[model samples]
Target chain A: MHIGALHISGVNLQEVEQKVLDVAVNIICDEKGKDYLIVDDNPGSEILVLNADSAEGSKILNNASENQVKIVFSSSTQSGKNIITMPTPVRVIALKNVLIKIAEQLYAYIISKKGHLKAVKKPTVLPEAQKIENIFQQLLQIKLANKCSLISSTGLPSIYIDGVNGRFITEKSTDDIEKYLNLDFNSVESKEISYEQLNEYSKNMPVAALNSILWRCALACSNGKLLPGHSENTPVKLTSWPNFSRHGFKPDYFKLAAIMAKQYISLMELNRQTQIPFKEITDFYNAAFAVDIIETVTDKSKLKKTGPIKSSQNKSILKKLAQRLGIN
Target chain B: MLQLNTDKIIFTGPVGAGKTTAISSISDTPPVSTDVNTSGEERKLKDSTTVAMDYSYIEMDDGTKVHLYGTPGQTRFDFMWKILTKGGLGLVLLINNDHPEPVKQMEFYLDSFSDFIDETGVVIGVTRTSINDQANIEDYQAKLFERNQIFPVFEVDSRSEGDIKVLIQALLAILAN
Candidate 1:
């Protein structure tokens, strides 16, 4: 039995089933369809081979001739008695097992999320985007509800997202927001005003000073970490990922938590004051949470602890635990 | 019974120049203001925590309902100026005599609404006679004439409700003519 060109380095047959399962078609060698070639005949399979420089090597050609796999190669070879005319590198065929696995995983994730793989079109609101934003806002609101004793604005629609935990409100009519919510927005007067002159004036002001004001306000209102510069949020760690920090994706949970905490405090503070307009407080809170003033974290962790974590206000509990452990 | 429709007129000027007091004198009801304590930066613009803007409904005897918007003195909210001027028929630019450069303030409003004034006439309202002694309201009136073709300029105390109404009447007359 002559083995033909059996060089496999980068190909992981274990995941091959998964990668090509959806695209791969089963081709039965016999009429009964019982025994299949289990071959990945999909055009997309070409993505597997990143480079074929080594396959053009003379040694590899010799290896193929010895294997007697009836090599019909792509490249012209100088020597080989049994070697058929060559046009390209010897194609290494694999069992259909890996492609099957890829198809299974893809369908499983799609089903789990109730999502169907569709080509993304520009300017269209994707359901997945709304879902992610909803999850983030819910997490922030839940965290803030527990941590802050008071919230400032009443009759205002605002959502807080964790990882940036920033409060975003529609200063414009809730028409756009209602479209996203897929519901009618309650009628409320919009009070947040943007002064073109003032906005431009602030742009001329020192960004560092503005950041300092934002940090100080957030710190004074509640206990939250003032991250270094703007890009210092904790990175998100997903459990199923192949490797940590793969492709440099970081999640900023701390900044998100801090922003929500401040918004909760500011809203509550506004509510406490009878005469102060709630809209102004909302604007201040928004200014503080502006992306330019804060940063996000990029380091991801492997721990997948779900559920509402302890509120930021319950630092005393941690302190007590520290005392019990005799650690300061 | 002559039914008249009143358009929203936003009076924007420096703080202590009495934007709220000016609009309140002519409005049927007290204006809703977002007033708060002056932060360190705002104290320079306002004697106290001056209101950013006051919204009041004005119903003309002719059944014309107009809204009057008064902005706070601090330049901090120049952003809100655009929103207030979005559909404004015209602006009543109030100038305070107490400010060393009342003309400069008028120029600021004009520059802010240069585009708006291009489409609609701006009525200049000068408040506080004491500060106007050096050049008087007439000097500013001349300034307005030089800058605008249809700009209506007047001298009045924004503190008195009736006197401020006179200014609105002047704006109405200019708009009517």
Candidate 2:
């Protein structure tokens, strides 16, 4: 039976093409005896007839294999068994059978290889739009967590501040701080203090007591009320032990803040100790201040000017972090 | 007969993070799933959740077949998490950004599979990030950093074949390294 258009590529291109066409129509024609379009230059032609002995045929075969395009070759050709081949004499029936067989084999191969062809492409670096979106997301989370808000200064419900016991004992009537601390509010004096007075009162207290009072004060602060003298260089100390699991601060930051609270540390010192970004430290500072867990040390003489820390050190730390992340 | 030559990678995430959909996207064959209708709180997110696991495979031209297994997201089915990771070469942790606590969920999964992760490698795919970008890949990376971990994290769409491939490819690359 006549196969469809076959591209003849060999030393004797014209002769092969004509002979194949005649054989296809006269002896191997299909039920309708239709003429096959045996072209010499149709690269898109599904069927290819290549002479085994010719260099051009070898090149075509190599090209086809590289492109994953199957071709019909003369039987004498030294090629893989997976390739389709027919005798060089161009017997009419043999040619017909070989063409039909190649078509069937190609169909089966295509069917079997469909899944392999569907492998998806690899992803590239995130685009700027995606990066901007990511930043927006982080900001939203910070806002939702109230990490971005300033600690309120006044009208906080009366909390019992006990320096000797190292606790900011709150009234049993208050639901906010008690839910977190789970402490008995009984037998404690309830007093309301302004942000300035609380800061003044915390100056003489032990670090532990200061930690408790400040954390309570921070918790008591109204949302968006700025803590007094809250600045990057402000000397601050953690007053109480940080409950990491409860607070949800990153472990490293929590550890750094814990270290800072034990000893009076300026915001800059905390940043240097933790290598955490200033903005993050500020967020933590605000949160800590609002809850009265952190207090500013007014003794400027104790705050030695550690000098200007190099951004290179911070860069190296970031580089190390990026390296750990396997990002070049 | 024991199929010792077969290799596999595990997929895990919170409920509705698209673990099943991810496997189905890249699997050469229709994946086998043991999903059932989600009851109680989980139903609010999706109708069905994977009860046991999801399974599918991709056969390379060199005759190597890599199996994909997805674990159930809910903690109630966490028992299957360890079971499915028996022969896994690595893990692809898919976190849904739109979830109430995406970072918390990431930490939970990483902790749950820390043993397997310590043995093999892991790559994270944060899905639905476009829907809610508040908890980005860096946030997850920061959490991993706290654990002293460094993993490839990407934003992916579970329904996209390309995104799933990128996630799997990143895991394979980590394994190769």
Fnat of each prediction, in sequence: 0.00, 0.00
DockQ score of the complex predicted as candidate 1: 0.01
Worst 10 residues of 2 chain A by lDDT: A119-128
Q: What is the lDDT of residue B147 in candidate 2?
A: 51
Model 1 agreement with the true structure over A1-328: per-residue lDDT tens digits: 0011112222222243333221223211211122222333232221232212244444444444232222232333233443322223221111122222233333344444655443211111122233222221222232222111111134444322111112232333322233333222222222222222223323332222122222333323322322112111232211111110111111222122222322222244333532334443333333234212211221122123232232343233323322332222
Instruction: Tell me the lDDT of model 2 at A157.
Output: 35
Report, for every candidate in turn, its global Cα lDDT versus the true structure.
Answer: 0.40, 0.53
State the lDDT of candidate 2 residue by residue for A1-328, as single tens digits. Answer: 1133333333333475446544543332221123333434454445555565577767766665333333344545344534444435454333443444344344444445653342221111122233211211222222222121111213333333332112333333423343423222232222344323443454443333224334343433323333333457766665432433223343344345435633567778767866877666665666564333344554456456332222232233323322332332
Q: How accurate is candidate 2 locally (lDDT)?
A: 0.53
Candidate 2 deviant stretches above 4 angstroms: A1-328, B1-6
Q: lDDT tens digits, residues B28-57, model 1?
A: 788777888776755776646455578886
DockQ of every candidate: 0.01, 0.01
TM-score of chain B of 1: 0.83
Could you tell me every candidate's TM-score relative to the true structure? 0.32, 0.36
